[model samples]
Target: MSAVTVGQELASVPYDELIKNILLAMVAAQNEANASFIEGINDLVGTEVKIKYKEDSTEKEISGNALAFGILPTLLQIQSGIIEIKMAITLQQTREFQVGVKARMGFRVFSASVDAKYQNTYSYKVEGSSLVRIQVAPAPPPQPLMRAIEYIASKTAPTIP
Candidate 1:
């Protein structure tokens, strides 16, 4: 006799929660960066820096800290993603039996011999794995957030006398 069996993972991953947590972590990091940048920009916001370049004959000066002009753009983007899994298993059982008899007779007496054999074997194996992957790229901030940042920057600009 023979038997075969297949098996897979017993526990499942909660993909929805994993994705949500990842996105939330990204947002939290961005918020932290924005807060740090705004705090540092406060010192440079009111200060003016002069730049002199002999383009033709006149010097040009730009009075703004670029960092204070806008919030940092989002650098990570959730693009294409993929998940894969593979599983393999095997099970086997075997039984065998043998019987033999022999007899020899001469003139007066007879003799007989008997022999028997039995064997059994069993085997099992299992293998499996899973993979998760995600592709990402740099991305600009959302339009609404960009607009708000622009408005805030414009209002905070220092007036030149």
Candidate 2:
């Protein structure tokens, strides 16, 4: 084997920075892959997750501050909801970690939906008009009172000598 000779040292990067870069890349990839889901999540944040039974059974929901959090939390909640969903999807292999499925009995099935959201305790509106309109209006005409104002004679009349 021939010995290699170099005049300058090789460039080195920090593990923390490398890890951060990898994490950012993974996050970006995840966002891209689940673009629609993310978009849906953003829109559905602050809304209720409702599960309804028979028409005679009335309604059920998870709402208020708990549901009004930001998109990330909402997405996480939705992710957690997979178990609540009880529907198997993306399963092909026998592996339990890779979106696999199994059969179960006596599990209740419910409808999931988004409800009107008034405000989120954990989230705020980031996009909207910030400038406030300054309005000025002329003061209202003085009203007649017992002693507040005296009716004066017309200016067109002159005082007699």
Candidate 3:
């Protein structure tokens, strides 16, 4: 019996379908990230900070949003939060053929006959990996939005006498 193996493309899974599924998952992840970022901004906006000072024979106190310290740096981080995902997939299929032969020899009337058989089998393997990277270098916030946050910060900031 002789066995032969041949490499072939995987028939069950297609690259396009795999990529489409990956894209769908990425969309869902992006949605979740958006929700989380919104929650973070809301929390930051609600946070409060205070400062106190003493003047000659007098005491004064000031109150402001926590972001008042540095709206540009604080909001820059929040608004710049971004993420990217990459994926690699490999699919393999193999076909193996096993051949068998049986022979009979006879001296009567010098007659000979032979019989042969072959069997084919298939096997499949799939390998996949993914990489995730986060990018925080998003473009700067719009001027109007920055101005508004700065205004809020200035209004809430504590005063020193």
Among the numbered candidates, top TM-score falls to 3
CA shift at 20, candidate 1, in angstroms? 1.7
RMSD of each: 22.4, 32.5, 18.5
lDDT (Cα atoms) of all candidates against the true structure: 0.40, 0.30, 0.44
Kindly provide the TM-score of model 1 when superposed on the true structure, using C-alpha atoms.
0.35
lDDT of 3 at 24: 66
C-alpha lDDT of candidate 1 relative to the true structure: 0.40
lDDT of 3 at 126: 17
lDDT of 1 by residue, 97-141 (tens): 312312122111111111111001112122222233444443565
Q: TM-scores, in order shown?
A: 0.35, 0.19, 0.39
Better of 1 and 2 by TM-score: 1
> Looking at candidate 3, what is the lDDT of residue 65?
61
**Worst lDDT 10-window in candidate 1:** 111-120
Query: lDDT for model 2, on a 0 to 1 scale?
Result: 0.30
C-alpha lDDT (0 to 100) for residue 50 of candidate 3 = 68
Name the better of 2 and 3 by lDDT. 3
Q: What's the CA RMSD of model 1 in angstroms? A: 22.4
CA lDDT of 72 in candidate 3?
Answer: 33
**Residue-wise C-alpha lDDT for candidate 2, range 1-161, written one tens digit per residue:** 22222311121123233335545654565566456644554454434444434445655443322123322322221221111111111111233443423423322222111111211321324232122222323233325421221212122122222
